[model samples]
Target chain A: MPYYRCVVPKDSVPYEQRAAVAKAFTDIHCGNTGAPRSFVHVVFDEADDRWATPYFLDGGNRAGRSEEVKAELLSDLMGAFREITGVAEEDFSGRITEGPAKWTMEGGMVLPEPGEETEEWYSHGQAAAGG
Target chain B: MSRVSFNCTMQEGQIGEELRAELAAALQQITQDVLGESPDDVPVTFSDIPSGYGFRGGEPSTTSLVRGSIVGGVTQEVREDFMRRICDSWMEISGCTVDELVVSARDV
Candidate 1:
């Protein structure tokens, strides 16, 4: 009963790649859960408003912060997002919303289980300094 | 002992290690409930991070990647309801804020 669907716009992805991800999604999870492929739907939402990015904040033994430093940190994530997702530009919805996001998973429109790891990550992260 | 990093800050008791293990199951269950597919049919995976190292989950996945579920297509009010219910439960275990949350919804 798994239905994997992509919520992406045509402009953001080429048909072939999109299809490939869906297939990969199904191949990985399908049958393992004893569910039919038709039941799974993986969605890819092509968003022009924001891009996934990572910023290194200032911490003695940790990463650094500062616009320039943040830019330096985000360089890799920016490249990775484009390379992996085939996105054309980079823009964080941080301002449109507020504060830049480490990735879209936290800021974007997504739903995972409450006790899920992502929530754990969030709770753990909230405990850390410079959140 | 500071190898991990986090996307946001949180309280220690807010999110727990036990729930971390349960996340993958929860995400799988959520997708399965909406799509009516078996757990295998759910493509999304849930990962967790420990310690105060910061950040949750594993590494950031590339965008060329296509990852999302059908449950995201539910009505806004219904979706909010789902998130709200979960948030209430999550808050007890960990320190997750209601704001700065996102729900993925893409047209297939």
Candidate 2:
């Protein structure tokens, strides 16, 4: 399973900032994943403009900070998360797992993916003038 | 018991196959360079995933994972040095940008 599901406002912040947030969030949970960092899934969720706030917290859950400052804050949090967990983004496959789901069926390591990325279209082209 | 871990990410000229072989050779060389004899065999493994994106030079900018195991009682510093050399060689080969590297002690 993915490390954790994230809910954030899309238009509220930029995509880069969003990715950074995802990275940091995954780094924190990487410890639990047991997979280093590469394998940790940082799935993104767009908060509906209707609600106007991400559901992670209550009362506008604004993360208690402004968007401008949130970017840097997210980066710092990622670094701190890495340091605290001692998890590397690329070592997600190096998790230590006990054999045979013993003792509560502990997981979070051994992220075996299914299928592959079949499409990689660089760009789209328009139709020609008059057939 | 003792293991020698290496990563093939961010700038790579060689993949795990090359890395595993290079590591084995490198380990033997290190033993000869530092220790007197090439006492015993070492275990090593490499990871290859096509799901992630690889840089122009073949190194991955997104992220990746690789592993290797070496026998014998080698010091942490020695193991780290070996990993660095492998990482450097990989960078030279694939020219991938590395995110980070780490090692863990696994008792097998």
Candidate 3:
């Protein structure tokens, strides 16, 4: 599961744009990793004092992307935030983390090992069932 | 190369100064040993969650959650070992159950 936890300032993003923001994150993640949209999980939380200054560092997970791919994802995410939240790039920041594939679980089923995703999750439909 | 961020539920003053410093050092060591990243570069973030705001299984969560990322290609054994160390530290420091202290990692 290429899950992402994005913490934005409270009320930074308008209510109507929330769904599209999630989709944007999913698309960027899937495009970079070849993971299906169904397996992507994105949660947007409102930041509070608990988070250190520059709450965008809240965190994210990546599954074997090269630096180029990671950059692309980050760029896309920045664009999404700009569009959805009307926030400037200089004011917004985030980090994409890398995780092992075997640790990811969905519907109580663990994903195939890394580098085996092509054989197991080849398409959106097949990737969903993870057969 | 690997960073682990913990989004947890805790009231003010729940995680003490000594425990926080210890946990940070432990995680840095794990990242250095397991992922070959410099302890200095291993980024760790801890975000607090209020009790009523987070949930597990439709019930209000009484425990904390930790989700994070690591550099790709570390062996499963190493990953598990790192996870166990971090989770155990969190449990001891926060008094949260193993079940409540969820920790997962992704590779970049």
Identify the candidate with maximal lDDT.
Answer: 3
Between the candidate structures 1 and 3, which one is better when assessed by DockQ?
A: 3
| Cα lDDT tens digits for candidate 1, B1-108 | 111111222223444456654544554555445445576654443332122211112211111111243433456555444444434434433444433233232323
User: Where does candidate 3 chain A have its weakest 10-residue lDDT segment?
Assistant: A122-131
Q: Could you list the iRMS of every candidate?
A: 13.6, 14.8, 7.2
lDDT of 1 by residue, A27-102 (tens): 4433233222332333434333223432111111011124553343234333433444555553321111112121
Per-residue lDDT tens digits for candidate 3, residues B1-108, read: 335443333433446555666677777776677666787876666655533333222223344445557656777777676667667777776675544444565554
lDDT of 2: 0.34
Among all candidates shown, the one with the greatest TM-score: 3
Tell me what fraction of the real C-alpha contacts between chains A and B each candidate also makes: 0.10, 0.00, 0.09
Question: Could you give candidate 2's per-residue lDDT for residues A1-131 as a string of tens digits?
Answer: 12232344444434444455555554443333233334343333344523322323111111123344444434444454344334454422111112111100001112122221112200100010000
Clashing residue pairs in candidate 3 are: A62-A97, A98-B70, A98-B106, A98-B107, A98-B108, A99-B105, A99-B106, A99-B107, A100-B107
Report the C-alpha displacement of residue A92, candidate 2, in angstroms.
19
Residue A77 lDDT, candidate 3, scale 0-100: 75
Off by over 4 Å in 1: A1-131, B1-17, B47-68, B71-74, B92-102, B106-108
Stretches of candidate 2 off by over 4 Å are A1-131, B1-45, B52-61, B98-108
> Residue A70 error for model 2, in Å?
27
